[model samples]
Target: MTAPEPGTDGQSVRPRMAQHYSVAPEPDAPEGYVAPGMPGAPVAGYDPAPDPAEPSAGRRRRRRRRRTGLAVAVSATAMLVGALAYGAALSRVQSSIGWLAIALAAAVAWPLGRIGGQNRTLPPLGALLSATGLLLGQLLGQTLRLHRLEGTPYGELLGDALRIWRADRHPVDLAFYGIALIGGFLLTRRTASTD
Candidate 1:
């Protein structure tokens, strides 16, 4: 069989070659329309969709601050309650049950630290709050005791309480204080992530 001639059997060789090689034409775009990723595109009214998986930085920061604030408030309130309870008990009872304060401090501090979130500042904050609570409890107990015994005036109660607590200190009290400090510090430490 010989080579097919042009337009043979009503089919042109040029048309077949053109059909094989021709590229599809691009669609016409509207005026002022810029294709995505093109340089200097106006992008009028174009708001990029935010990523749902990742929150905005400002939102994250605000959330963190709110959490930290809540933690601090709750921890401080707990310490205040513990101190008041301890002081009340100590004032009423002549026996030395100060060791119980260690448990109270750890109990309050550990949960506070965990609630405070994973941060570098939590342990030190817990320890400071614990120490403050213990000191306040002692002073308050002494103040209440003096008030009960001598009807001490409100203005002079603090000074008298300080003097009384200073005079009443014992070596055993120091040991208990140190243990409380250690417990608060250690128990408030960040736990390993189970995740």
Candidate 2:
């Protein structure tokens, strides 16, 4: 019980025990001198060290991409099959009549395909062009059918169809709706993968 060492309020003073008896200074490194085996460190002329794991990284990346693509493709195909079944269920409405809906769907699909094809290495322009051609072909087919069905010419056919669909509430197949939805999903996934 010697006199308490002073702290802020004159408490007993005591030296804190040092954990280390002594400390050594780090070796002084010369300018640009790097220790051996350190990353980016120069040894003599600084030859590039080969990455031992690069090939494995690349393989794993490719495998991941393949799996993703396979999953997406399978899902899309399954959806397409389900949509076809819905179309079949509506078979009574005269699928010949329903081709109009198909045509409209194609028209919408082409521009979307064009957008999807942007800057692709081989340029998916071929797919876009096919979509456009299919849409136009559908239009022509409708025009021909219009002449056969209602004594209308190719010129006045579009106006008549518009009037019919607009005035008469024809039942639309939910499958086309499904196609459009799935197509959008496929487009987004494909774009993201490319990036």
Candidate 3:
């Protein structure tokens, strides 16, 4: 066989290679296949490298998600523990100790605000959830205690709990919620992405 001559452009005078094409399978589509353009169309060059900002953006997002989750978990745990502590103390200390529960609620905001993601809304959101949980816990304990005293039946306990949930809340309880809300706003701050 005769060797092919090189082009004057310093490139080999070679036959064109077979073109390659790829299509994604779609169940609902015709023939269960989907391609960018019609058949026999010129195949455009495709750069597989991802965008410059994609990895960083994704990493930051994942990091933020982790931080947000951590903040929420911590806040919730603090609120529950606080509620239980306050309930236990309430049974023991005769003097007023409501402030302790409020303080606990307020304290949750610090960690949440400090570690919660860039969303300025998260701190206050966490605080609100925590405060609400605290109030619910207190009400729950009160309802259980009252029900026990009244010798409430197991089947009717649900009704009693509902009544307690809808009962008029004390101003002190409202104050605690407000403190937690404000404290959350105060403690929350934007932090640099660690990743």
Candidate 4:
């Protein structure tokens, strides 16, 4: 049979066929461009970029923030309630208790944030509401006190209470507002990126 096909050592060579069961590569792509994550070995100087959509095993997922409207509403409500509570307390105590109001406003911010389901925005809103509430509460207390005076006419106390802010001698009133503002600021401090 044509000299029986010369063998490697001058003997007859075997006639077995070659076999390949692995996945076939695309005919169009060049031989060197191997896809990532494949069993094929990685080629040098061609590291594939990590996919943005891929879920990394090493990193934590980021949490999205809550809406703003709910935050503001909750903060305002907390501030108002805190101020009213402080004012009512102040009226009974009947003294320059600005510090107490400041403390109350500051304390209310955390709960306000919690109510809004957000770490951001609510604290400042709460502080603002608290300060305003405190101021209003002070005016209310003043008006109530003036209502008890001997010759004060009805509805005149409002004007008198408004005028109190202008009085030069009433340092305590100014201090109340100032402390309220400062205290609000101090309470709403953001320690981390979350808030």
lDDT (0 to 1) per candidate: 0.75, 0.44, 0.63, 0.61
Give candidate 3 regions above 4 Å deviation.
Answer: 1-57, 91-96, 151-158, 161-168, 189-195
- Across 19-138, the per-residue lDDT of candidate 3 in tens digits comes to 665965445766635466967544679545687867766787888888888977887787777777665555354344455544665656656766775666675675676566566555
Residue-level lDDT tens digits of model 1 in 1-195: 766676757764654443443776665988777777789675779867879897877887788767767777887888888888888888898877788768667765765666667656777777778877888888888888888998968578999889878988999888777766777777777531211
Put the candidates in lDDT order, highest first. 1, 3, 4, 2
After superposing candidate 4, which stretches have Cα over 4 Å from the reference? 1-67, 117-123, 150-156, 190-195
Q: How far does residue 155 in candidate 2 sit from its true spot (Å)?
A: 1.4
Give a tens-digit lDDT track for model 4, residues 18-103.
Answer: 75859865568776866777678686798588789974544432322333455456556666677667656655775667777766
Q: Which ten residues in a row have the lowest lDDT in candidate 2?
A: 121-130
Compose the digit string of candidate 2's lDDT tens values, residues 1-195. Answer: 775558886654676655564676666988777688877666687656657865565786676555544544443343344334333333334343433343333333333333333233212322332233333333444445556678866578877654543454434533433444444434533443332
Q: Give the TM-score of candidate 1.
A: 0.66
TM-score of 2: 0.31
Any runs in candidate 1 off by more than 4 Å, and if so which? 1-50, 190-195
Give each model a TM-score: 0.66, 0.31, 0.52, 0.52
Compute the lDDT for candidate 2: 0.44
| Per-candidate RMSD, Å | 10.5, 11.5, 15.9, 12.9
- The most accurate candidate by TM-score is 1
Q: Alpha-carbon error at 83 in model 3, in Å? A: 2.7
lDDT: the better of candidates 2 and 3: 3
Q: By the TM-score metric, which is better: model 2 or model 4? A: 4
